[model samples]
Target: MTTTSTYDVHTVRAAFPILQRTVHGGKPLVYLDHAATAQKPQAVLDAIGHYYRTTNSNVHRGAHALSAEATAAFEDARAVIAGYVGAARNEEIVFTSGTTDGLNLLAATVLTSAQPGDEILLTEMEHHANIVPWQMVAQQRGLAIRVVPVRDDGTISVDDVASLLTERTKVFACAHVSNVLGTINPIAEWSALCQANGTRCIVDGAQAIQHCSVDVQALGCDAYVFSAHKLFGPTGFGVLWARYDFLDALPPYRGGGAMIDRVTFSGTTFNAIPMRFEAGTPHIEGAIGTAAAIRWLQEIDTTERIAHEDDLLRHTTAAMTAMDGLTILGTASHKVGIISFVVDGIHASDIGTLLDNMGIAIRAGHHCTQPLHQRFGIDASARASFALTSTREEADMFVEGLAKAIRMLR
Candidate 1:
C-alpha cells in the first residue's frame, strides 16, 4: 500500500460529470453503488463521441479507407485490453456482450467435452451469472454439479476446494472476488489445484477487475471473464480471455458473419481464434471507449488511488461496526471496497429506500448471489460499494445517512 500524496479525490471526481449532479430534493448525489456499474468519466464519453463523429464504419469487411481505419482502431483496443489484463497474446481476447454472455459462451462450448457423471465444481459465493450457466450446461451434458461451501466468515479455503475435487471433476468455475461479501478468493492456488486435477479453471472477474490488477497468465486460469461497465467503460461490452490453445480447441459458441471463413453453399469453414468466438458485427465504439477508460485509469497513480479506496473502506467499516443493531455480512480478512450489512428488525429495502431519499445511491437485494444470501440466513442486504473516484466525504455521508435511516425505521 502507498500513501495518497499525489491522488486527489476531488480532482478525480471532477472527471466524472455524474458526480456533480443533484438527486432527490436538491440534495447532492453520493453515488456508492459501484459494484452494480461504475459511473463513466468524461474521457470515456469523449472517446465514444469522437469515434462516432470521425470514424464510424464496420471493421474487417470493407476495402475502403474508413473500414481500414475502424479495423485498426478495433484491433488496437483489443491489444490495449489484452495488456491491461496481462494476457499472453491479443488473439486470446474475445469480445462479448457482457460477463453473462461470456460465461454462457464458455459453458456451452467447454461443457461439451464432459461425459455423464463428470462434475462441474463451483464455490457457494458465485454470482448467478457464474452459477446458472454451469447449471444449464450440466443439465444438458448429463454432468453433476458440486459446490465448495463458504465458511461462516464468507471466505472459501483452498483445502475445502481440494477436498471436493476428484478425478471426475471436469471444470472448476469460481469468482476472483465476491460481489456481495467483498471476499477476494484464492484464485491462483485454486487454479494450480484445478490443473493438477485435470480440470479446466474459469474465473469470473467482473467484480475484481476494477479494483485490482489482473494477470490471467499469472493466475494460470484457463479462462477469465469480465464486463467493461464495471471498469468505468460502456455497458454491453466485455472481454473473455482464455489460453490461446484452449480457446482454439473449443468449438465456436455462435456462428454468423465475421466468424466464418471461405463460406459457400456446399461447406463453410470458421475463422481463427477470436473472430470464431465473436460472430457478429462487434461493438466498435464500445471497444474504443473501453480502451480510453483503461488508459484514463492508467494515467492515475495506481498505488495512491488504491490507498485512497482502502481508507474509504476502513473508515466506513469502522463507522458501521460501531452502530447498534447493525451487522456486517462478511468479515473476510481480505476484501475489496464493497460492504454489505443488515440492520436488526429493519428490512434491507427500507434502508436503501431511506438512503435514496437522502440522495445516496446504494444497492439493496441479494446482489445476484441468492445462494450466498441464503447461506448468511438473509434474503437481502444493503450494500455500499466504492470506486477509485469515491471520496471519504461520501463515505461519511453514507454513514451519517444510514444512521438516520435506521433511526427513522426503528
Candidate 2:
C-alpha cells in the first residue's frame, strides 16, 4: 500500500505540538486514539488565544465595537463551516456543545413530533450518543425503535436498511462511519431510501468529517451532526446541519437571551433558524478555533491526506494480520483509518495498560458501541485508529509494543 502522492507527514506532525512531547518516563508518544478525539494544531490554539486577547465580547447582542467584531468573526466561521459541509445556507448550521448535545437536542425536539406507534430506525454500530437519545425519546413518546443489524463482516447492507424503512418510520438515524469498526456506512444510499419512505434521515458524522469529505447536499440527508474536537479543534463545540425548511418548522429547543425575536408579558416570538436553537451565551472561542482547524486542514491536499491515512491503515493492518492469535474485528471493504482487534487469551484492558507504559495511546473497551461488541460476541476490543498526522514509524512502534504485550501476557 504505497501512496504516489507527496504528503509530508512530518510537516503535518510538526503542526501539532503535543506530537513532539515525550510521555510516561521519556518515551515518544504514539497516538492511535484519534477516533476518540484528534489532537489540536498550533493554528487552532492561536486562534482561540487571539480571540480572548483582542476580541473578547459577546456575539449578536451589544452595540459596542468589540461585540460587532466578535459577531462578524463568529458568523464568518459559520459560513466557512457551512461551505465545508456543503450546506445550503449558513442559517442551517446550528452550533451545539458537541455531537451528543446536538443529537439530544434533535431527539427532544424534532423526533418528539412522532406520534404513538411511529417507528424510529437505527443501526447496531451506532455510538451511545446516537442510541440513548433516541431510546429516551421513543420511551417518552411511545414510538417504536427498530435496528438494522451489523453483518459478521462488520458492515451493514443497503438492502437491509431499505427493508427496515417502513411507512411508520418517522426518523432513520445512523453513523456516517462506525467509531469501533471504521466501516463507512452508505449514507447516500440510505438517505435516498429514507427520502422515498418519507422518513427524516439523521447522520452522526463525528467520525467521518475528519477522515474524508462530507457533502450534506450531495448525500441528501435531512440532517448531519459532528464535533469540532474530532476535527482537531476545541472540545465542547460542534455543528448540526439540517435543511433550512426543516429547521424553520421546528420549535426552539431551548429558551434564553439570544434566541428571542420579541419578548412581552403576553407571548414571545423566537429568533431565526440557527440562533433559535443556540440558547444562552454560545462557545465563542470554540467556534473560532474550529474555523481555524477547518482552514488548516483545507490547506492540505485532500487526496494526499486521505492517502497518507490509508497507507498507514494498510501497513498497520498487514503487520497485525501476520501475527498469530490476533483477529481484526472489522473486514468491511470500505473503511477509514481504524483497526479494532483482539488477541487470544488476553483481555483488552491488559493490552491497553501495557501499551500505555510504552507511551502508546489506543482505545480499549467497547469504543462506545456496546451493541456492536455484543454483535461480535465480545465484551470489548482494542482499537488503534490513525489520522493524517500519524506516521509509519508510529505504526511500527505500536505493532512492536503490541507484540511485546502479547508475549508477556501469554
Error of 2 at 57 (Å): 0.5
Question: Model 2 over residues 341-379: C-alpha lDDT tens digits?
Answer: 999899999999999999999989998889999998999
Task: Give a tens-digit lDDT track for model 1, residues 281-308.
Answer: 9999989999999999999977787778
The TM-score, computed over Cα atoms with residue i paired to residue i, of candidate 2 is: 0.98
Off by over 4 Å in 2: 1-3
Q: What is the lDDT of residue 296 in candidate 1?
A: 95
Q: Residue 5 of candidate 2: its Cα lDDT?
A: 72
Superposition TM-score, candidate 1 onto the true structure: 0.98
- Cα displacement (Å) at residue 107, model 2: 1.0
lDDT for model 1, on a 0 to 1 scale?
0.93
lDDT of 2 at 227: 99
Question: Can you tell me which runs of candidate 1 are displaced by over 4 Å?
Answer: 1-4
Residue pairs with backbone atoms closer than 3 Å in model 2 (clashes): none
